[model samples]
Target: MSQRVRGVISRAKGAPVELTEIVVPDPGPGEAVVAIQACGVCHTDLHYREGGINDDYPFLLGHEAAGVVEQVGPGVTEVAPGDFVVLNWRAVCGQCRACRRGRPWYCFATHNAVQKMTLTDGTELSPALGIGAFAEKTLVAAGQCTKVDPAARPAAVGLLGCGVMAGIGAAVNTGGVTRGDSVAVIGCGGVGDGAIAGAALVGATTIIAVDTSAEKLAIAKRFGATHTVNAAATDVVTEIQKLTGGFGADVVIEAVGRPETYKQAFYARDLAGTVVLVGVPTPDMTIELPLLDVFGRGGALKSSWYGDCLPTRDFPLLTDLYLQGRLDLDAFVTEEIRLDQVEEAFEKMHGGTVLRSVVVF
Candidate 1:
């Protein structure tokens, strides 16, 4: 049976999102319906509102979420009704070339619900990142539901479905941060802080966090940054080098998608060190680096999509760490708001007043 639920929707580009009734159809083949418990307001939701992602108007706007699996359709075996899960955007297709090569994280063919969730007027809604989870209930491919510990707070764990995971994955997976390594993370937002925490989790001895805001820098310290560089007050590159014994960091994770930060990450790493770009860059933005420097750098310059995470492997591991009090996932949740407060949450996000304002249903 179909369920009618209240959800946040962006009717058009540059318009405010509205809480409206959306009809979620029953799970189709290889799909499942989730009773969303909590969802995080991510920057991607705002991008969807601004039409920066695509021309899919009247979009169902939330993606980073955790919920209970309410039902499953045909051929679903990974999860069952009543399972608590974090919804992920990537539902890897094992047949993709990336998956064929055993790199499922780069799977070119991820899956979503074969059916659509439509408006009352019968117009189809493009779900943000294929999870449209700001609503009380959401439909997704069965593979999107990665079951985790129910004891963990839904609001906190839900964040792992997106930004938090991206940041952590950037450092551990893409940046290859290791014990005693010197790592610097540019931009101390939720994502950057996650990178710092991930570095610390892996025993990185020198963790430097660079951000324009002193408030965010303070927050970074709580997340395991050994040092903080206020970009607004000092030269980021120089400050990072100074903190690392005149040598740049071994791994520099760029969480702020601007070209300036990208360049900072490039020059702020040691010779043969990795630079991981996890921040989403705009289309008009481009970076130009000296070709000679690119050759001399002699290391990996990689971009992380969803932190290059394999949700099934990473989500459960992180949840266990969080449960053991080793990972402070709760620090990422600044406030919990109701669904109607999404716009206000977005404003707080824009003002950098909160790491994340989660919507709890």
Candidate 2:
């Protein structure tokens, strides 16, 4: 039987999300139905509302989430009913070339539920990032559910579904940040803070946070930044280099999608140091660098998609750390609101006020 629930949806371009009735179908083959407990309000969801991601209107917003599996379809062995899971957008197709090569994290063809969740009137809804959980219940491919410790707070660990995962994965997986390394993260938002926390967890000795806000810099320190550079007042590249014995950080992560901030990240890293861009840039956004400088840098320049994360691997490990109090996942949750308050939360996102305002069902 199909279930009816309230969900946030952007019915038109640049329109405020509506908390209206949505119809979720029974799980089809290889799919599952999740009872969402908590869902983070991410910028990606706001992007979908602004029509920034694409022209797809009538979007079911919300992706970063944690929940319990309500039901599973035939052939869905990845997760079973009653399992606590953090929803991930990447449901890797094993037949894809990247997966066949043993790099499932880079699977070229990720998937979603075979059945569509829709408006009560049967109008199809394009779910944000394929696992829209800004609702009471959501349908997803079984592979999207990564089982984590049931004891973890849904509001805190659900962040691993997107921004947090991207940030941490950018440093640990993509940039290969290691102990005794000097790492710098530009942009002190949720993603940047996540990188800072990851660096600390993995024993990066010297962590520098660069941001325009003094308040955010202070918050970054709580996440384990050894030094904070207020970009609004100082020269970011010069400051980062000065803090790293005039050499520069070993790994520089650009979390701000703006091109100017990216250039700062490029120049603020040591020669042969890695630069990881986990920021999501717009389609029209472009950057130009000196070809000679690129050759001279002699370092890896990488773009981290979903933190290059294999959710099944990283989610459980991170959740365990959160449970042990070794990881401060709780620090990311600035406030909790009901589903109807999502529109208000979107306003605060651009104001640089809160790290995350989660919707708790």
Candidate 3:
């Protein structure tokens, strides 16, 4: 039987999200239904509402979530009912070339439930990142549900589903910040701070946080940033280079997906150092770097897709770290809001105070 539940939806572009009744169908083969415990409000969700992601209207509006498995359909064996799980958008296909090449993290074909969540009027809804988690329940590919410590707080662990994971992965995985490396992170938001934390966790000798806001800079320190640079007050590349002993940081992570910031990241890294771009850029956004500089800078410039993470591998590990008081995932939960407060959360997103406004069920 289909389940009718209240959910938040973006009916059209640039319009406020509405809480409405939605129909969640029973899990089909390879699918599972999850009862959401908490979902984080992310920038991607805002992008979906503003017609930034695509022309997919009537969009289901949440993705970063943690929940419990409620039911499983035929052929679904990855998760069982009552299992505590974190929902991931990328469910890697084992048969994909990337997986067969021993890099499942770069899986080309991710999985999602074949069934559609719908509005009460029978109109189908596009689940944000293929996990419509704003509702009481959501249907997803069984592989999307990664089991973790059942004792973990849903609000904190859920963040691993997206932004935090992206940031940490940008530093640990993509940037490959090793011990004694000097790292600089641009944009001291959730993602940037996660990079800082990841750098500190791996013993980066010097971690510089660059941001326009003083408050965010201070927060970055808590995440293990040894130094702060006000990009507004100083030239980013110069400041980063000065902080890294006049050479440049060994790794520069750009969390703000803007061309200008990316250019700063490009120049802020030491020769042969990696520059990891974890920021999500709009389709219209483009960068034109001098071909000479590209040739002169003999380093890898990489984009981190979902932090180059394998959910099954990273989520549970991070959850355990959180439970052990090693990773402060709780700090990312600025406040917990109800489902009805999503619109207000979106309004405050740019206010810079809240790291994340999570909907706690």
Instruction: Report the C-alpha lDDT of model 2 over 1-361, residue by residue, as the tens digit.
Output: 9999999999988888899999999999999999999999999999999989887779999999999999999998989999999999998898999999999999999999878999998999999999889999999999999999999999999999999999999889988998999999999999999999989989999999999999999999999999999999999999999999999999999999889999999999999999999988888899999999999988888999988999989999999999999999999999999999999999999899999999999
After superposition, which runs of candidate 2 have C-alpha atoms over 4 Å from their true positions? none
Candidate 1 lDDT over residue span 1-361, tens digit each: 8889999999988888999999999998999999999999999999999999999798999999999999999999999999999999999999989999999999999999989999888999999999999999999999999999999999999999999999999999988899999999999998999999999999999999999999999999999999999999999999999999888999999999999999999999999999999999999998899999999989889999999999999999999999999999999999999999999998887789899999999
| Reference-based TM-score, model 1 | 0.99
Candidate 1 weakest ten by summed lDDT: 344-353
lDDT tens readout by residue for model 3, 54-118: 88789998999999999999998888999999999999999989999999999999989999999
Q: How accurate is candidate 1 locally (lDDT)?
A: 0.95
Task: List per-candidate RMSD values in Å.
Answer: 0.7, 0.7, 0.8
Name the lDDT value of residue 177 in candidate 2: 90
